[model samples]
Target: MTRRSATLAVAGALIVALVAVASFFNLPYVVYSPGPVEDTLGEWNGQQVIRVDGADTFPTEGVLDLTTVGVTSADAELDLLTALRAWLDPDRAVVPRELVYPEGTTAEQSRQQNAAMLANSQQNAEVAALRKLGYDVPEKVVVDAVVEGAPADGVLEPGDVVVSVDGTPVAAPEDVVDAVTAHEPGETVQFVVDRDGEQLTEDITTIAADDDGRALVGFQPTPGFDLPVDIQIGIDDRIGGPSAGMIFAVAIYDTLTPGALLDGKHIAGTGEITADGEVGPIGGIQQKIAAANHDGAELFLAPASNCDEAVEGNNGDMRVVPVETLDDAVTTIESFVAGDTEDLASCPAS
Candidate 1:
């Protein structure tokens, strides 16, 4: 062969090798895609998704779905080609790795945090649902976390339900903090807690807080409450997050109420719900919208903060309703079922 032709062939081979290597080069980004939409009123693995005891659950119709986003695990490596595809795809999202998994965080640590959040979200959902039904749920202080090398490290543990502090009954977390702050640094404070149905009292020394010149027990406490009825959510262990809290609360309320709230319409939504029924924003709003659309949902309830993404990423005919709280969601559903869409809040398209 001619020398010129031989050089051209070599150059072509080099180009092909470069493209192949680029296809396998891992990127430091994660991809978000549409996931499955699980109907909370339906069944999973031959069992009902939401089961209630100690109360008469009424028969309900229609769908109350919790939408989820398929996210790449923090430990999973993404290639350049996949990231490029996700960027170009309107239904998918490409996010920075650090945004999804913070620096110095391991995959196991992230999973454990998600699991803990899921547990707390379930408890909060129950509280919200019961309170919406006119049930009184008094809050109590519970130990959420213990700091290492702190005064309450070995003395207090997570899941310990605090009943009183310094011989005074503590009803709220702030009360516990106030009781501790009344003492001087290095002074011992008595704490009465119920651990796994057993009452125990322990004295822990107080430490000085760095932010304020107040005494602290070196433990994080959160508000908790007892439920009148037992509520069980039968979701897969792989799905762990607080994003489904709002949907879970709605499903529980529907199951306990007299009639069907959905009126045989398919609806899907995602948001973090607080005990006071506030709906909080979550990540991957676009992917969640796609999942609901793919599931044939006629209406999608999105957090008010996510209206921009929801409006931009919506490609189907499903109406995206903006909701700020659990009460807002229930009212929207009722109005939609009654065929009154003029008064409902919808995502504005600019």
Candidate 2:
């Protein structure tokens, strides 16, 4: 072959390699996709609580005691790319995607996503079911912190209505999630909140730094609630992650109560647990069930909406309980604990 032709071929191969690398790293803005239609149970105390049975409330810690958890922060595009790369290839080339976040994303977005993913997952569904008996629902907020390193350390707190972040006003909860996640951690962000009778301004530090050496602040601007049953609810769009909080609440309550909620049986679940006992469906239910199976849970409690995904993703060794109302969850737990037929049926499909 001619030298010129050989050179041209080499150039073509190089071009292809570059394109592959770029595609691997290139993160793009996903079209704004809204999740399931949440039927608004409406405004009592500015909370949108879906009244279901069997869910109970839990208490809150003075400061978030999350020594056992891990956290990361980045714009939406960056985060999505990070996940994709991890799923695709964790050790090879870091994808070349530009850090593009959903328009108007902020720190609040990261906090909410993380909270939803982690905190609520650790909670007990039966304890969450307790919220219904008291007629209480989850509270939504836009927070602005007025203090730091103390009780009001983060600007976003319980009962703060977030209007804008760093001058970007978000209209929906996802918007807030997207916005807060747009920045690197450790960046002090200004949040404008409508707190009760007046407007307040608060700044929260971003998450701790990642391996990339980006700044991160390990704080979430969440709202916690005090229930009639000595339970508390902690929720915030500012601390986006997952629903481990609700799960943690339930687990703690179960451990502290007389009989064990696990009943010497293994169980697993995934969902966003609101302070008001609402169990909202989450993404990747199939992955979560696989996680449960790995953990050896005999039963898997999943949101009714995500039941199909959980069943399809599961290996079928575990019984899947699709819970809707807090009451339904409690009944299931009681039945499981007593090893007796509570004569309970599955929650009505959402």
Candidate 3:
């Protein structure tokens, strides 16, 4: 062969080998794409997603979908070709693996965390929905986690219900914080906790907060509620997260109420909900918006904090309503059903 032709052939071979290697090389990123949109008012695996007992439920019309984003597993390897494809697709997103999984986190640990978050979200959703309907849900402060080497590390354990602190009754998680912060650093504080239905008292010295000078017990507390009614949420075991709290609350409210909230219109949303009806921002808002739009959602409810991302990700196929609270969502849905769109908050409002 001629020298020029031989060089050209070698270059072509190198290019082919590079392409093959690129296709097989694993990237340190994760891909996120539009996932399934499940209607809380409908059924999953032939069973109602939301079932309430000890209350009268009326037949509801329309869809109240809780949108989700399909994320690559914590341990899943993404090749260069797959990453490139995800980057090119406007509906898909590529994020660093560390951002999603963090350092030293195993796939099993990630799944456990997600499951715990999902369980807590479901409990909070029920509380929010029931309280909005005039039902009382009494709550107590429960220990969720204790920081190692901290003051409460050996004293407090998870699942221990904080009944009181320094003889002050603890009704909520904030109560525990307030009780702890009321004392100065190095002061020993008494905590009465319930462990496995048995009452126990323990004392631990307080430590100064790293960010501020306030006293801290060095443990995370979450609200534990005694729900007035029995509400069961049937969702796939594969889907686990707190982002569906807002939609779960709304769906439960609709089931308990006498009228249809959506009025046969299709709607989808994503947000973490507090017991006080506040809507919190969640991850993967862009991918969720794409999922909702593709799943035939006529209107989408987005947390106000996520409005900017939602607007940027939207394809203009569906209207995106920005909601700050559960009340805002109900009001928006009611207005939409009534055909009154004036004064409603929308993403990219101009």
Cα lDDT tens digits for candidate 1, 70-156: 888878899988898988998899889988899887889889989988888888889999999998888889999999999889988
- Cα RMSD for candidates in order: 2.8, 14.9, 3.4
- How do all models score by TM-score? 0.90, 0.44, 0.85
In terms of lDDT, which candidate is stronger, 2 or 3?
A: 3
Error of 3 at 337 (Å): 2.0
Off by over 4 Å in 2: 1-25, 29-101, 104-109, 112-242, 274-276, 337-350
| Candidate 3 colliding pairs, count | 0
What is candidate 2's lDDT per residue for 297-349, written digit by digit as tens? 55556778777654445335666677764445656766865776446443221
Better of 1 and 2 by lDDT: 1
Q: Which ten residues in a row have the lowest lDDT in candidate 1?
A: 308-317
Query: What's the TM for model 3?
Result: 0.85
**Backbone N/Cα/C clashes per model:** 0, 92, 0
Question: Which candidate would rank higher by TM-score, 1 or 3?
Answer: 1
